[model samples]
Target: MRDINVSTEAHILEAAFAVFSQNPGASLADVAKHAGVGRATLHRHFAGRDDLIVALTLTAAQELDEAVETATAHCQTYTHALEVALGAILPLAARHMFLATEPAINDPRVAEVYASQTRDLTHDIDMAKAEGAFDPHVPTEWIVQAYDNLIYAGWAMVAAGDATPKQAAALAWRTLTQGTGNDAPSARNPWHPH
Candidate 1:
């Protein structure tokens, strides 16, 4: 009985992520339809939209924490760590990107987790700069914001069928490290002088 309830709850959460991610204004009925569960089932698990959003936010936070931990583990260089982290995180865009602009983020529980994650990410950015993996001249806060925006862009590309998740991750890493420039002598660009 407990196992069945757990499965049902997970299904509902997955449906909620899909529905809410695409349409933040989607109703609980939409989630119920997506999950193939009745409206009562969703309400049984989540008392209201706020309750469901909180659950999703917490789940996303836990997934992100795990991804960062796994990416940092066994990586010899900060560059590699960042790449691995991007690869791990880009796929989760659909699951968490909505939280970026969601009012639910202002919730105390969501804010606490996000604050901790930011602190950890800031520490990693500082270490990356010290190790010469990231530009030392750039502000750490700017780098953090850029990293986040890049993740969103990568997700958008993937969502739009412009690139696979792996391709998007690679492109994001390249854009971050190399910028959008062609230094080849044959390349035609006003910015480049022969």
Candidate 2:
């Protein structure tokens, strides 16, 4: 409706994601101002707020698909793959965490992408078990669930300001690989070295 240039839509979407991530109830005018575009321009691209939300969800899913592919591209060890995958996905997860509360986030179209990601995670866990990276007795599904939980929890910690993104990633990797148990045979305790 107003200045809807073909090149500006990407800018509008990126601004919308930034706005919505902070304030899910943000108005289209808020998005437009943040995008440095006219309200009508945003409206022309997205008829209403719901349309914009759906578009954001789709964008996040697509980005996540690419991130996963890039993280696993080199066929490293399963633990390394998991570490890189978490590093790649954490920022996206922070942006899209709002999707967890939106009913439309479960749209079948986006669900397909999420399902593919899940399958990839499951396959990686299987590989980890086969390679003795994970405890062989742990079920693949349980490990997959723990991995998913850690990703969510890591982002949650970041959102809460309890940890920086770097610290969160390190915490997730350490917790996943070495649990809280004090079973390691070090001459001195790692947690309380004296």
Candidate 3:
């Protein structure tokens, strides 16, 4: 009985993620219908729509946190770390994009999740700079923002069925590490010798 209830709750949360990602203003009944659960059952797990959105946001933060940890563990270089993390997060990117646009997403708990990521990104940027893998003059924040924007763009491509997740991640990595400019070894080259 307990296992079934737990499973039902999990189902509802996942359903909410899908429905809300497509439409943030979707109601609890929409989630309940999507989950194939009665309204009563949905309410039993989440008091209301706001409660469910919060749960979804927290779930996204938790998933991102776990992905970062996993990527960190398996990565040697900072580029590898960022690539792995981008791959880890590609699936959740859309849901997060939706949740982040919500007003209530400013919750400090969510901020902490992003703050932790910022710290990891800062560490990786410093490490990459030390190894001469990234241009020293580029601000860490700009690189992070560029990486983040690419992740979202990659997610959009995947969501539109334009590319597989792996392909999208690869493209994002390539675009970030190598721009469309001339490949001549000059100041424009990311790998230009310092």
Each prediction's total of clashing residue pairs, residues at least 3 apart in sequence or on different chains, is: 0, 0, 0
Q: Report the C-alpha displacement of residue 34, candidate 1, in angstroms.
A: 3.0
* lDDT of candidates 1 onward, in order: 0.81, 0.76, 0.77
For model 1, residues 33-150, the per-residue Cα lDDT tens digits are 9999999988999999889988998988898879878867999877688878999988887667676666677689988987888887788778777777665556678778778789
Give TM-scores for every candidate, taking all chains together and pairing residue i with residue i: 0.81, 0.78, 0.78
Q: Which residue ranges in model 2 land beyond 4 Å of their true spot? A: 1-5, 179-194
Write down the lDDT that model 1 would get.
0.81
Top candidate (lDDT): 1
By lDDT, the candidates rank as 1, 3, 2
Model 1 CA deviation exceeding 4 Å by range: 1-5, 21-24, 179-194
Worst 10 residues of 2 by lDDT: 180-189
State in Å the error of residue 150, model 1.
Answer: 0.6
- The full ranking of all candidates by TM-score, starting with the best, is 1, 3, 2
Tens-place lDDT digits, model 3, residues 78-178: 76777787778876656676775675546677677678877878888677766676666666777777887898898888777898878898888888776
Top candidate when judged by TM-score against the true structure? 1
